[model samples]
Target chain A: MNWILLATIAALLIPIYEAWQDENIWQTMLAFSSIASKTSIMILIVSVLRDDWTLGVVGVIILSVGNAALMLLAHIIRRTNEL
Target chain B: MSEQLYIIPIVLLLPLTGCMLVLQVNPYHALVIRGIFGAIAALVYVLFGAADVALTEALVGTMLSITLYAVAVRSSLSLRVGAIEDQLKAHTARELLSVLRATFSKHHLRLEIVPYTNLLAMQAALRAKEIHCSYVLSEPGGSPSPPGGGSRYDIQTRVSRLYEIMQAEVPPTKAYLRYIDLANPDKSTEVPIPEAMEGKS
Candidate 1:
């Protein structure tokens, strides 16, 4: 279980680096999208390992809410360009 | 704490992204990095057995705050320059526009073009402080030729600070910088936000 968590942490680093290195806003956005989902999924895995129902529920909510936020942010960025 | 070795790495990620956010030169890019920071922070909260804190971090911290900040940054980090409808179509105006855009972006400011029907309306807007700046082709008799010997544009700005920035970066040959001091204290920038809110309410 601990090894699984370490692997997830390793996976998370990929996007953090991408976000730091990419100069384009959209690419940084893609990295943010990746990091948000990855963190929630890691939370879900931890919940399953610890057998915590509350943590699992929170992870599920974050997963869906992250997508909603991405849409809102993308729309705002698009609108700025049109003006 | 051998069983919690993963906690060290997870917690360390917060500072890593924080530094990235701090180092970012662009406002829009910094906003995206902020979202990344919030997501990592929520995960850390969950690891510390703070489930409700994690939920709040995700909903309000990451979701609501980033969207609000994005809109705020987009609107605030902009420079609006008014030009006459006829002036914008000219070759030299377009050249000056490109130069202005490049100069402003280095300071993380976006340049926006507001076209007006005529010089009278454009000057009115500038006097009312409706626009931050305006430009018009210089008349040969009105102003001497720049050393480069091409037609020049006058970049009139009410902002003293903006005049300084433009003065430092924009070439003298492309445009002449003029700072307009609004003598009427009542009509200057101080009152518009509250006045508009009062009108709406």
Candidate 2:
């Protein structure tokens, strides 16, 4: 559990690093989705460890819904940019 | 200290580092950085056993706010205009530009004008979406106008959903515009000829 916490914490930096280095809007959105998924996974782990079903439900919602919103926004932006 | 005790440090340190890093990024990269900050904060809430706070951070902070920011950024609209070189050289064109600036500002849009040597090039730019619109003059030469004869401003914008917004927001330029054709620039080389003005004075 401790090692999982440490690894998730470490993984959090990857999106920040990618965002800083890449200037493309789509790439930035990709980084955001990555961050969202990783964070949801961390929440899920914490919920399982604590046996908190409510927290587990929240994590599931984020895991399922968050990336969809990001992808939709990215698509809209990209289409607008092409215009 | 117990190994479990170090979880507090991980929670505190990771989010703090993310916050500091976020502040260091350029504003253009802010969307992604903001999402990263929210994620880190949510993780911190989970570490503290505050599942409710974590959920709020994950949903509102991470997801909803970022989408709102994206929509806001999208609304910072800009329009590109390709002008015939002869048209831009006219005195009325400058006044038209100032009017455009005043009018477009009402809708929070910025207008950029790029001059092209010929109508064909201007039309091409508009068709390619390289420019949102093009400006053509009713008369090209420095001809003295007869009595009751005036210059017609033929501004053609790429037909889009936003065209209606632009039309509704048009400032009072010298001439009123009426759409005469739905001509596609790609297939048409037929240009609108300026009405030959008879010297009436």
Candidate 3:
């Protein structure tokens, strides 16, 4: 498997494991969000290192969108529980 | 003018001379002295038609050397943690003694115990314009104590501001931050612990 795929798999599983171990939901959410954001940046770094400018640009754009979505989701979840 | 060809080697020797002089003397006092000599040497070389050599020597010998020496001074000031702590403690004791000696002091005074850590000292020094930057060591899986928890948050915020400053002042390639965990010294360990039975003879 590609390193990116392996990283994504690890990122996805970490939150699940934390949740299973009865960790706080907010902490788990933060971990997941941080993982997503970091992974996107890591992919961009790898692409640039490989001299793949196109892939790097795409990775950055995707990362920006992913971060915004994650932040929005976190806010909504936080707000819904308060209501 | 074939005899003047020897001037090229002399031009190269100028920076070497500056290096040796600076190396022998303490940099704190000798930096300006070496810089002046180096600049004069570079000017002489430029007059001799060695423009490239002159330019490099002028930059590296004078400007870069002075900047590096200044940075060293600042780093030394910051890294003298033990001395700073002793000074701070002495100052505090003197202040308290003065307070005790005063008559008719009605104000309820509380002694605020400021925890003296390397991180705290660095931050104070930075704020006081004593040092430009300092590194903080963090360990993985380590939780902050109650008072330190707030201090840790403030340190992170300071670091983020420092990052912005570095990005503006330095080139993108040079503007980088690294977190080194001193507690967990080795990063290549596969297993944290070996099987219990493996240790049994």
Candidate 1 residue spans exceeding 4 A from truth? B147-149, B183-201
DockQ of all predictions against the true structure, Cα-based: 0.74, 0.27, 0.01
Write candidate 1's Cα lDDT for A38-62 as tens digits: 9999999989988999999999999
Q: Candidate 3, which CAPRI tier? A: incorrect
So what's the TM-score on candidate 3?
0.26
- Each prediction's fraction of true contacts recovered: 0.89, 0.50, 0.00
Whole-model Cα lDDT of every candidate shown, in order: 0.87, 0.66, 0.40
Among all windows of 10 consecutive residues in model 2 chain B, the one with the lowest summed lDDT is B185-194
Tell me the tens digit of each residue's lDDT in model 2 across B38-124. 777777777677878877887888678878776776555677777877677778788777777787655646677788998787766
Across B50-131, the per-residue lDDT of candidate 3 in tens digits comes to 5456456545655566556655543342211111233344543344324322311222121222334566675666555444
Index of the highest-lDDT prediction: 1
Query: Clashing residue pairs, candidate 1?
Result: none
Q: Model 1, B15-85: lDDT tens per residue?
A: 99999999988888888898999999999999999999999998999889999999899999899999988
Look at candidate 3 and give me any clashing residue pairs: none
Candidates sorted by TM-score, best first: 1, 2, 3
